[model samples]
Target chain A: MNKTIFLLMIFLSISAFMLVGCEFGKYPLILDSSVTSGAIRVDLNLPLPVQVTQTTSVNISELRNVTGESVDSMKFYNLTLLIDNNTSPNDAGITGTISVNDNALVTLTNVNISEFQTERSIFDKDLAGKGFQYHAGGVLFLLNALKTQSPDILNVTVVAGTNASSLHFDLKVKLYGQIFANTN
Target chain B: MTRKRSILFTIMSVVCLLTVLTLQVRAQNPLEDAIKQLTSENAKGYLQPFVTAFGANMNSGLYHSADISQLGFTLRLDLIAMGTVIGDAEKKYKATNPYDGSEVETATIFGEQGAIVEPIPGVQYQFQNGQVKTSFIPFFLPQLTIGDVFGTQAIIRYVPIPEVNNVPKVTLFGIGARHCVSQYIPAVPVDLSASIFYQSLEVGNLFEAKTFSLGAQVSKSFAILTVYGGLQYESMSMDVNYTYTGNIPGITVPDANVSLNLDGKNQFRGTAGVDISLALLHIFADINIGSATVISGGVGFGF
Candidate 1:
């Protein structure tokens, strides 16, 4: 009787110990989201062919609604520029610049207006010397603002080179990146 | 008195050690975070290793000895703890970037943080976070065995683990019966038995799994120690349900309900183990080799 009682007590103790404060392992958290700067209309509707620049303000506050939560840090991977040509006759030539918060990050030169749709990575050779780090920093700076639920507006200035045929097109910037947080 | 005191001390030491070891692991709410932001396609790769390893662990530790008493009343209970080793290949899988349909190699649930891949210059994709950063999957459950009438025994197992991190409670239940095969063969030197078992586990509405095993075992007793070996065919499957909260550019629907049915890689296993009986106390350990390697051990008290 004594042995049985002792064994029962031992089992109960082990069960209680196993029940309380058993922890599961924690893993890193990675969240991904895509943000886009809607089409920035660049209408070179001038009497004489001349260079034109258009500035649009874009804020990624909508990312909060997309990710459904705040994140600690973010890094952008792909940046694609989709050019929707609205004019009948395509432009002779086209070039442009992309900036974050007025800080130039990308510069396009001698771009094929006929094939204007191209994707540029942040580390693209074309964006090497053009304040690449600053562009990344500025974008992330705005993105991380979602952490505080207060996103800052990013300025995108597009410089269209001299074009003929009254070049009318819309330039849209699409960005894909990952958000990092430790929700463990 | 001295022998009894020594046994009591040993049992207490084991209990304390297990308690301390189990307490070292801390609970975090990674299950929800691991799959919540992932599309069904990506979630499958991230969680496949867990499914396989978990099933392997569940299918192990079925028996420690093949000896069955002949027409007698005997009862036993065991606290079986099992772990299935995760292979290097299982730690990672090929994941597809939902935006571009490009394949990338990323971490599984048992791996390190996922890989960030740039299929092209601008489109960077990162897979979901790995849930458990370990080399093996582990499980702990209690089993009860009662026998014998006409050289047959029945086994049952049930365990309910309390919820942590807002995840639902995890429950496991199993039933099996073993029949002595050597009883019909007169003067058999070794005890032989054939057994079949079925088990199911559930974790709230998020996960559900089932395991089936059929096998034959043989054993020989030496005083208080019994050596045993078995060959078993086992299978397991898990179903996972989660909401697709990821922002894949082409997915037109939001909050799409995603369900995955996954199977374990292990189909057969060979096991070897020894059981030591001291009065009414029993201790056993075993290792099983199959598609995955699994180790199990437990302590029990019975007559």
Candidate 2:
């Protein structure tokens, strides 16, 4: 009986060592709900909605696809996002980010962003309509369509107060059946 | 029809039909083939359709699976699983990594994004200190590519006219290479690659004099054209018997003493070409205005 107890103590000590090692394990970044995974190349942009106070219209075309590389087409669907307070009108700060899969920073600051998508479907091609607006103070929020299966997502933030408040959103792109051309 | 003629014709037709059927079956089996079908067919165009239509995703999927031979053995297995098949191993493979030394690596992506940036009130970005920097518009290019048969060709031979008549032997060789040309025009940089190739063409016997060749080729691309050139020096060495008149019955002369330079009499070649990327497909053409002139047109996929 004494020998069995001694063996149990030895096993417990080994388990404790493993648990401590795991505590210091290398998991610098953890994948959470806010992160997106799959990214594709698509030519789409979001023009800044009307600035509340500023006379100059905010340009939304700055947010680009991965690496800001020029994409002729892309498809994405099912996305979650967060935006800070910096996209407000009174503040000239970093642009609000549009999340694709996970990696963000899709746009730098102060640039005209426009979105255009030529979606491929089983039968015909449709154009995706996009828009953006200032949420409250300076935060800019946006959504666009990538393809029939893929939708564009944005993580919006307004850097207006003493500290920025992060906002979360889950977005899906819904396309209208008839083609809408810019008649002008 | 006469009985004799009909009988003979029936036998002959049966043989021809069998041969045609066999060839057709083999053509559908990709592993029974080299990349030549993929590469050479590319030269004739339609590579994009072949890829998109034939579940070329299988090729990419297999590549991302377990590691494969340079000849894509893993892909061949996947093709087999997909109901497409390969026949005859030895005749099919020109060169394959028999050892399967390389291991497969799995790629992972980010699961979620953690933090985000926001705007500030009454704060200026300083607008780069009111500096207006203007320069030329920058350009960009895509990465990741794989291909075989940078280039290749054949030869015929005859003995020095002793035991054999002009009915000499023929030698053949399969040539291939992996080419990577990284042109960063935005960075104004050019990375080129050059390699030496050895190939032989033979109809039957190795005893027949073998033509030895050492060839070098270099490839580069500008905005308009991609240029490549190489020299393959082929020569025949001889074992000569001399009549010194000494009459030594069993005395042999020498083994491979001198190499005959076949530069002018043998071959040299050069080429200039261009490839225009057309969204779904790409069109490429090359013209060789040199010793061994050949003009080839090719179409393939960029993805």
Q: Largest DockQ belongs to which candidate?
A: 1
TM-score of each: 0.72, 0.20
True contacts kept of 1: 0.38
Q: Write the per-residue lDDT of candidate 2 for residues B1-303, one digit (tens) a residue.
A: 356744653454334323322322222212111111111211112121121111211111111111112232110100011111111210111211111212212111111111221122321110000000111101011112233222111111111111123233332232323232322122424333333333232222211222344434344455534444433343332121111211111122243222121111223334455554434233444443332233333333322
Give the C-alpha interface root-mean-square deviation per candidate. 6.6, 35.6
> How many pairs of residues collide in each model?
7, 42
* TM value for model 2: 0.20
User: Each model's DockQ?
Assistant: 0.23, 0.00
Best by lDDT: 1
Task: Grade the docking of candidate 2.
Answer: incorrect
Off by over 4 Å in 1: A1-27, A35-58, A61-70, A79-151, A155-175, B1-28, B97-100, B119-125, B162-167, B250-255
Interface RMS for model 2: 35.6
TM-score of chain A of 1: 0.64
Q: Compose the digit string of candidate 1's lDDT tens values, residues A34-82.
A: 6778688877755654767778766655554445444666655455566
